[model samples]
Target: MKKILVPFCLFLVTLAYSQDDLLKSLDSTQTEESYSTATFKALQLVTLQTTKMPAKKEFYFVVSHRFGTVKDGFDSFFGLDNATTKLGGIYGVTDWLAVSLSRHTLNKMYETGLKYRVARQNDNFPLDIVGYSVADINTFLEKDQYPGLEFKHRMTYVQQVLLSRKISEKFSLELVPSFIHKNLYNPDIERDNQFSFGGGGRYKITKRLSVNLEYMHNFDKPDFYKNPLSVGLDVETGGHVFQLIFTNSQSMSESGYLTNASGDWGKGDFFFGFNLYRVF
Candidate 1:
């Protein structure tokens, strides 16, 4: 009986040691990957783009309106009577890719664009980076207005690289380097290519509200054009977001606002505007 008991005890000790060794090996081989998210709450922060993208299969419908300059005072109902509007929709094809189409009333413009997340901020990354490109077609121009207008001349292209960082729970900022090309340009006044730098930021004031600001400076703006500047507030309500904005730019498209904005904020030449976004 003693001999049988000694053998069983030895076997039990060996099994316990083997199990411990196996657990240590599994722990050594295990790896964990980390990811960060939500650098911005919306795809756009006022007139500037953000690094945010919708989840796969999600859709967003946006309606934007910019009224005439407040210089008209109450005569134009604070610019509401002479408003330019845009209707747009965005869809997420994948977790990191989104496509959008929009129509603007100002130039009777049609725009199509896509945005991709190149990289995201994580424990190992410093900033979130995104790539965006758009093509705009001006359909309102009549052949009679420009005697030699061609089909290709009506198109413009814009590309941008967005870099964003969330410095704190309440603050976020982004920088954009943009290139714009117009197929047709006025030989005496306008150039075919333009470059601009844009900066925007958001500061959270509450759980559902934030203050936003955006500015774009064109390096080769014509004498008649002024840089664009916008300030606004973002109010979130579940599936909808309402943006109340004041901007110097009358045009809503990137090609139009970045290069052709003519108003000055200091001179009370800014327009009152708002953007409504509904997600489905």
Candidate 2:
């Protein structure tokens, strides 16, 4: 699936209209309104979620791929030898509510989540507030390895509140306060309930392109687990958003990235990945 999906994403890039053509009307609309539009072009920013949802009844398909640490250089084919893939679909049940389902190859993880826009950054509001609830199951755990494994041991849940603002015409910022619950975990390493604070920003360099940066600080992570930091570029072309990222995170799920990020940017321990979101 990784082989096919990765190539398919690249193929779509070739068929998209030039960036300039898609943003021709960008300058024509300069009226400042209380409710912002296109604060972030995509629904995601690297490893973080953005305060954007599809239109009512609209659907979106997303493909994400993360390669191994590039520190090995040519020894590991620049991380191509060990790659992980995630495939997901999202649907907006209403203009303010969305639900998503995803499967990640790592840990044989399956995740489902709901997003609701509780508040919009309008004249009466100061920010765009979105609430998220997600749950995931890890099917990779083996009963043989753990003599006493239960269904609950494989479960994890996450709750996050996304607060964001379009600071200016060319900049947008978001803050994510996340609460993670693990049904089973190692006491020696961490606790069952964990909290992390994350911040991300998008600086528009052009109407169709922007630079994004995200970082998360886990207050309860073990010493060995480094904070996840991701920097990427979002290329918007009509119904598709292509993201090219360099991140110190190997996991695509919220629980995984928040507490289990294993890479370190200082040592060049980072992965190269891309996320392709297509509107259907």
Candidate 3:
């Protein structure tokens, strides 16, 4: 009886020790880091910038269109008869960086740009920050059309710092501080350098639908140009996003739309537009 009791006691002790060791091992396992994601689905929220980039090795083909002003009241098919279009492609060099090239029909302009994610929003960070820069060349102007126009006169440059935060699963907000430089300008009426600030937001309505709004205030706008304001809806499918927009801006490039928009919303001068993005 003593021999059997001694062996049973040893077995119970060993079993209890093994169970303790197993619990400690489980407790020591690492937990995943929590982070905020999808602050903005697409790169641009209407005319304002968003801190979004494609995944590494991915490519995005985008087509954008802005019809004539709605003030035409069916004379121009309520801004459908006349249109300005842009076609662009964005390629992701890495998870945090992307490059894009686009052409606009309004001024026969070509633009190239780079977007870099400076920082990401996470449990420890409050904002997602991005840097953007672009160069545009206007090719529509003829020597005869604008006398004394040199190659340098056709160049425009834009720099922007975009900051955004996802306050909730359904709401996000962004602010953009931008500077635009035109190599040539009307000395008497226009300044060579322009500054603008933009604000935009997104509110998700359904699983795959959202409302977006954007507005920019230019500090050095000409008398004829009104500040650009746009509102749009975004619909997401599996691999494509379609945006339906109403905007007072005609130009698609940052410099073109920010500093050169000529429509007035109060006068019913806004136009209908759409942007389509397909990813590959």
Best by lDDT: 2
Worst 10 residues of 3 by lDDT: 25-34
Question: Per-residue lDDT tens digits of candidate 2, residues 1-280?
Answer: 3454466447435533333443353334434464777878899978888999888999999999999999999999999999999999999999899999999999999999999997666544456789999999999999998879999999999999898888999999998878899998999999999888778999999889999999988888899999889999999888899999999988999899888999988888999999999999
- Tens digits of per-residue lDDT, candidate 3, 213-234, equal 9988888888888888999999
Q: Which ten residues in a row are the worst by lDDT in model 1?
A: 25-34
At residue 233, give the lDDT of candidate 3.
Answer: 94
Alpha-carbon lDDT of model 1: 0.86
Structural similarity to truth (TM-score) of each candidate = 0.87, 0.87, 0.87
Q: What is the lDDT of residue 237 in candidate 3?
A: 88
> In model 3, which runs have C-alpha deviations exceeding 4 angstroms?
1-33
Candidate 1: list runs displaced more than 4 Å: 1-33
lDDT of 1 by residue, 1-280 (tens): 3454476458546744544354454345333234455567888889888999888999999999999999888899878799999999999999899999999999899999999998666544456789999999999988898898998999999999888888888999998878899998886988898888778999999999999998888887898889899999999999988999999998899899999998877789988899998999
